[model samples]
Target: MRKIIAQLFISLDGVVEAPDQWHFPYFNDEMGVAVDSVLGRADTLILGRRTYDSFAGAWPEREAAGGEDAPFAKILGDARKIVVSRQQLEFTWRNSELIKGDLVEAVTALKKEPGDSAIAMSGSVSVVRQLLAAGLLDQLQLLVHPIAVRKGMRLFDEGDAPIPLKLLSSETFETGVLHLFYAPAEQAGEGTYEDAKAHLPQDER
Candidate 1:
């Protein structure tokens, strides 16, 4: 089964939007190198409707223009992708598949499929929330920018559902971006409800 991996850029405050306002400068070569590295590792891409639209509109043209810093050109052009959108338009990217259904369900289905290459979810902060709430994300690659944007979208969104995680790895780049990788923390052996009650003591008054 393929693991659902998420790659996102976030501010110190967890903002994940444009990331250019306060301090997160994408134009810096140092920053670009950090981003390009993350983009290079993906073999499969998943995106939400809004993120898909943003990427499809700009990256394709950028690739055609032959810019050396086309961060996602190679992968986005060739990797298999699943876009969750209700836009009702056929995908134009190579090996792109449209998924028009419930977000969590569609993602869950994808994870169950047979594949070896790592599956990456890029951008799509909203989708990240849904997947986190559903406990569907197997791993996360968070590029925590040193500069905090103060405004715009956030990487991690709060949901009513309570889910826990374990920090699997951490890395720091030259540009001050901290990459954090996490895995879903498996529940410890607490046993059944009866076991819990037994631990509470036998009707101790």
Candidate 2:
């Protein structure tokens, strides 16, 4: 089964929107390697309507310009893109297709397909959240920056049901950005204040 991975560039306050505005100041070779590692494993890209539009408008142009970003742009342009949207859209980008039928069903079927490579969802916060809630997301990879944006569209919204995740691995970059990889877990462990006191210093206890 192909793993469905959701990769995001998030802020300290959990904001995932507008990475371009605050994301690059901390960029380094380590972060580049981490991002490329995730992209290298995925042959298919799933995106929300907004993210799809944004990429469609920019990456193709960048590819044509043959700039420093062109190589990465070509990767995005060549990958099979599945766009999720309720309303109809005209797909101008090559190898792009709108998702058919129910979102969960479509993604479930995609996961069952024969493939060793991964299916990656990048920058589509809503789609990621939906898939995570439906128990379809296999891995959640986050590059958490040290700064707080304070206001923007966050990954999790208010009143959302609690979802438990287990850390698979983690690494810290010199820029103070944390690369965290997580997978869904059965349930979150519970403990009381008195239970926590067991590990406290003798004087504090």
Candidate 3:
């Protein structure tokens, strides 16, 4: 069985939207190491409709332009992408597939299939939340930034039920960003993130 890893860039206050506004200044080699570690483990990319649309529109052009950052764009361009959507997607990026029926069934099947590790990244908050609720998420990675955007889409939005997690590992970068890795705990749906964070060491946390 393959692990479905959901990764996100989240703010101190749980905000995950428009990360470009506050995410770049903090980017450093340490963060790159964390990102590379995740991408290195996955050959497939899972995306929500919004993230699929946004990445499909941009990454291709960026790859074609070619630059110092082109390798990352190329990785996305070459990887197999699966987008989960209710409505049919008219156009899709290269090497991409669409799942338009029964999100849970489709994703669960994907998880059981033989393949390299799979990863889900930004703009997939709703999908990730549903996966957590269904216990379909195998791992969750959060690059916790230091600032609070105060008024943007939050990662842990209201109405989201608590999902328990066991900390696999955590490392704090010099940039003050915290790289947190978690696996769905056996305790499962019993506790909130605050409860989970409390389990981390005061220094590493």
Candidate 4:
């Protein structure tokens, strides 16, 4: 089965919106490698309407201009893009299509389809949240920048049910950005303070 990975550039305060406003300052070669690693594993891209709109508006133009960003734009252009939205939309970009039927069911089917590469979802907070809640997201990769925007749409919102996660791996870049990879896990154990005392530091104990 192909894995469904959700990759996002998030702030230390958990904000996932408008990375263009704050993310560029911290971009480095390490970050580029990290981003490329994720994109390299995925042949298909799943995007929410908002993210799709934003990408469609920019990447194609960048590809046409043929500059430093053109290679990256071409990567996006060549990949099969699945746009998820309730309203109808005319897909102007090549290899783009609208998702059919229920979102969960459609995605579940996509995972089962024969494919060597994984399916990637980037910059679609709502789509990522829905997939996470449905237990369809196989991996959640976060590039955690060391800054707090204080105000923006965050990955996790209030009143959400607790979703346990297991850390698969992590890395720290020279820029102080943390690359965290996580997978869904069983519910975390609940223990009393006395039950946890055995794991406390010696000084604290």
Return the lDDT, model 2, position 56.
Answer: 95
The best-first sequence of candidates by TM-score reads 4, 2, 3, 1
Cα displacement (angstroms), candidate 4, residue 202, comes to 5.3
* Model 2 residue 15 CA deviation in Å: 0.8
Best of the two (3, 4) by lDDT = 4
lDDT of each: 0.74, 0.92, 0.82, 0.93
Candidate 4: give the clashing pairs: none
| Candidate 2 lDDT for residue 32 | 86
lDDT (10s digit) by residue, model 3, range 98-193: 875798998888888887666655558889888888898888999999998898888776674566789999999999999999888766445788
Q: Any runs in candidate 4 off by more than 4 Å, and if so which?
A: 201-205
How many pairs of residues in model 2 come into backbone collision? 0
RMSD of each: 6.7, 1.7, 5.6, 1.7
TM-scores, each model vs. reference: 0.77, 0.94, 0.86, 0.95
Stronger candidate by lDDT (2 vs 4): 4
lDDT of 1 by residue, 44-111 (tens): 78888888878788778887888984646856777777787767877776677887588787877888
84-117 per-residue lDDT for model 4 (tens digits): 9999999999999999999999999999999988
